[model samples]
Target: MLDLQNIRSQFPILNQQVNGKPLVYLDNAATSQKPISVLNVWEKYYKEINANVHRGIHTLSQLATAEMELSRQKIQKFINAKHDYEVIFTKGTTEGINLIAYALGNSNWVKKDDEIIISYLEHHSNIVPWQMLCERTGAKLRVIPMDENGILQIDILDEWLSEKTKIVSVNQVSNALGVINPIEEIIKKVRKNSDAYILIDGAQSVVHFEIDVQKMDCDFFVFSGHKIYAPMGTGIFYGKSEILEKLQPFHGGGEMISVCTFDKTTYAGLPFKFEAGTPNVGGNIAMGAAVDFMNSIGISNIQKHEDELLAYGQKKLLEIEGLKIYAEKAKRTGVISFNLEGIGIASDVGMILDKLGIAVRTGHHCTQPIMDYFKIAGTVRASFAVYNTFDEIDVLVEGVKKAQRMLG
Candidate 1:
């Protein structure tokens, strides 16, 4: 019942040729290509509803405002937030985490000498904000160790978490190793010991799963728009209703305040209190359209299709001589991280793959701690999506074979 060919047709970018060969875009963990519907929304906004939202009294202003709020509602249902106000528009996942960190840093919940815990598999976006918070507030940064397979050591978290722990921030799925973490169990355990807030970096997981922040009961969650087939310069930050209401405002400018009198001005309500200045109205509107497109296709079918692709890719890549696949666990995402034997280095292998027109990511994946643990610079990553097909994976495997031969 899942029409993959028809679905692929909706994405025009996937049909293009790259480097005189068909583009095998496997760098989905980096970002996803947008669909035609998403692009059209961008054009339609500027063409018809070009005006500042929530301020102008004209017809264009009303239309723009309506469309903007419609995006908020769409995101609300996407993540199943308790209220639309709980969802705040941010620049991306990085900004979202920073907003929560800064807001909590100023709150009485966290104090000097307190501990904010993170795991080794976190991206720099999740790590650095807490590190900076620790420096400013005298809070100590605690790291949860990962196992040899790159999965979070959930058993060790019981010992790591204590009364001193103020927050426990981690990724739901590792961008580098494609390991989907046991976040629900971790959250339930953390709650029994301390009132530490939990933030899930869903930049990778959101694309592959139907996220329900309310069901998960996480204190805060963040993800990027571009990762979920939306445009750049757009992202979402979800905080619990009570949690968001108590946090201090991070940015201050024109639209955030209710009435400015130079003498103790009162800030606007929940969402506007956090969203300052003019937002990317067009990008956010497009994000809503992107959500509509995905809903029409259904996320369950997408996940099923991707799971098959991942299994096929893993099985085929193992057949290649002198190649080692990382994260050989059953519960992994669509990303396949591996290294070619006899290749000088991952970078060299990546260069060869590039020459063969196979696009993939080769680096630390913004996860330096994990690389240090593995004692390797990085691995070559080929991540898949709904638009990707088995034929493309075959092309990628052949390209890797070619790279191995040339490099050896």
Candidate 2:
């Protein structure tokens, strides 16, 4: 069991007050609060040994390189990747997905008539890249539809999956609704039906549970660091060795190339080939610290605690009259998206909550399609993290009730 007080204490940001009341931070899905351990790692990197990695023989460079590589290995083991080389440092999940799409577009892999599949649950980051890919390659974009309850209609894949499908991308957990997608079943269906590349967007899911890229059998997996209590601008792109070897480099600069002659330039090996230019060495090291922090508490323990919070939050929030929770019936992580019946505008409710020292996300959440499906502009979203408490949920519940009373 996790010591809630001890865990909460580690995040100094949670202790402060907002709008004259104790802060109730429920906007974790946008970005998580960094713990002191991760912040210290970031400071130590700059204070002790800060230098460009793999390019210098100096002591500082060597030390920085070692620390960054150690971080890579930690992420590798954290996600259970087959090899460290399969893990490439990226700016975030958006860039990683763009890299894959661009590489595939440049290669002969995706043809003019090929189809790329995504679902309604995808973020704009996942949707726009494939749309751009389709424009570049003359490929068709297909979508796996979701039901009224925001559950993905996986059975539709039987008709969608065919020889023409070249790529299938889906999120393991919906960022907007917090619904846990049946990606294992989706992967199985994709493998049995078509010879297509599969990419799982794990930006939200990685924080809430254990991720095994090898066992998951995805060709590529990507996630952002800020969503998982690490520093911003740090992310991971995990791809199978053989698939990574096949794709050409996405960016061209210093570190990605072995020899740069005027006439010919040979690109570097697996991970570096994709990493191009200088990386976020300090942030990456801090990300490793974040991983260590998660391990210290244990992912399963964190999951259990968050699950309890979700259940409690849902039960309490539903007690509010005219409150409708999206994806309430679906299995979810620690997120709740809902709107009060008479409120009409979600931002108004968000503003009311903000004045009460509660932070929640409003608007389409970069998921306009979902909003369109529900025939609403957006929903007020409250996402959780390990440091969050049951009392905080009570605060949120009361805050929502206040918003409803004021608006409705």
Candidate 3:
């Protein structure tokens, strides 16, 4: 029995109007709106407990360190990771993937001629790392193709999984087309086909669905905090204990070193080994608050509400003449990437939407590879969050209709 009206009131930014019209934030795929709870925690930390963590004996230091660890525990519970140390904080998904790629590539596990498989629907963050790793090592990169509907070709993936494939990284959900990948089933199948390690890009999935790394049994899972209603410059990279122990450290600096001598140096353990330099203390702590906020409201509630919004948006948008929505899969998220007929440029349409106080993302969304596969320039994307409502969709529907007439 979650109260949607009460929840909407927690976001202060939603109260204002933009461009002389009611603000309609539909670009949630880029980043979500922050609630008061998240902002309050950040403000409290800066005002009260602003101190470096895990170093000093001062009371402020202790308080900051405790808060930081509490955040880790919260994240551990959020994704159901067995150990808190498995969650390593980084900048965002881009950094998370790069860390994995470099760490695994430098190890003996991923060697020359070893194949790393990624899907065609992958963002540039996922694709380029493997490409760089392949270039550095003599490892080969394999791509699993997608159908016209933007669904991954399971038959093709089955054929691609072989003994030489050492790593398989795929998005838990496609950001470009709103396609919810069958990651659990795909991971299970990958295990049977080969002993390859799997990493799931959970950027879009974490915000929209319930996630359990233990149940998913993925070797690594990565996501950004910004997309989950937390501050920017914070992300999580969760590696299985056994797998984490095998990979080399990705970065080296202050907190990550255990001992440094003239002869040799030793590294720290688990998460500290990955977190280098001064971590984003405020952003990391705020991420915990974000999880707390989502959990308090219930992830199931968020999913159900978002699904309802998506359905309402789709039905409403269909009423518009010559509008096309991508993907009709049973499993999907709240993202809608579309194009209106006779619209010369997606960018212009996006500008018009902005003029109407409707925020939407345009362009390839950093998945230019997918755009190249489909032979389309880009799409105008409108993704929803839990706070979104049917009324917002009506505003967007009217906005699109107006754009259609104006562009024509």
Candidate 4:
């Protein structure tokens, strides 16, 4: 069990009030509130060791480089990558996915008529890059369909998987519906049926549980640091060393180069090859701090607490007169998406909730396909974090009922 008080106190933002009421922050799916430790690290990096990394022989540069590399090591261990070199830093999950798509498209890995698979539940980040890749490479994009319950129909992969499939990218959890996809089964099916490389978008899953990349055995895994209590503009892209070695670099610049001449250029090895130019040194170090913060409390405890919150919040919200929860029967973590019947739309309900100092995401959540699948405009998404409480869940429930009464 977690000491909710101790955990909550670490986030100073939770103490503030909004709209004349205590803030009930449930918009965690969009981005998480930075903990004090992560915030302090950001300040500390700039105050004590602010310099461009891997570029200078000065003490501050070395310190910044060391600290940033230490963060890389921490993330490598955090995700259980086989080699630290396999962990490449990026702007966020979107960049990581784009890196993969761009690199693969440049190489012979994906070619004309090659197929790439994604799911109907993917965020635009996961969807667009592949679409662009298909456009660039003449590859055909394939989608795995979902059932009425919002669960992925993994069985259909039997028909979709083929020799021409080159990449299979999917989210470990649906950002829109909070549905946990059967990635293991999907990976197994891909391995059995096709030679495609599998990439799991761990942007949501990383916050909810421990990720062992070696165990998961996906060819590539990507996530954003902001989703896991780190600052924005920091993210991780983990690819198997062999696969990364074979693919071309996403960007050509200083840090990712081995030798540069007017006539010829050679790229650097492993992670550095993918990570080009200057990076968010402070943010990446703070990402390491965020990892330390989660480790101190233990990921399992955080998962358990959020799971409880999900169950409690769902039960309480369902008791309302005319509320409909999407993916109600699916296994979920840290998020709940729903619509209050008779309300004008998710945005109206979200505005009402905001007036009560309760924050929730309104609209497609960058997932228009999900809305189109359900035949709805959008949903009210109340996503939780480790610091969130049952009382906040109660507050959210009451806020929803108030929205219904006012709007309906």
Best of the candidates, lDDT: 2
Give me the displacement of residue 243 in model 2, in angstroms.
0.6
As for candidate 2, its clashing pairs are none
Q: Write the per-residue lDDT of candidate 1 for residues 53-132, one digit (tens) a residue.
A: 88999999999999999999999999999999999999899999999999998776778899999988899999999999
Local distance difference test scores for all models: 0.89, 0.95, 0.90, 0.94
Per residue, candidate 3 scores C-alpha lDDT tens digits across 355-394 of: 9899999999999987887677898999999888888989
Better of 2 and 3 by lDDT: 2
Q: Write the number of the candidate with greater TM-score, choosing between 2 and 3.
A: 2
* Candidate 4 per-residue lDDT over residues 1-408, each given as its tens digit: 799899889999999999999999999999999989999999999999999998999999999999999999999999999999999999999999999999998887988999999999899999999999999889999999998889998898999999999999999999998999999999999999999999999999999999999999999999999999999999999999999999999898879989999999999888789888999999999999999999999999999989999999999999997889999999988889999887748999999889999999999999999999898999999999999999999999999888888888
Residue 398 of model 2 has an lDDT of: 90
For candidate 2, the TM-score is: 0.99
lDDT of 2 by residue, 230-322 (tens): 999999999999999989889999899989999999989989999888999999999999999999999999999999999999999999989
Candidate 1 Cα misplacement greater than 4 A, ranges: none
By lDDT, highest first, what's the ranking?
2, 4, 3, 1
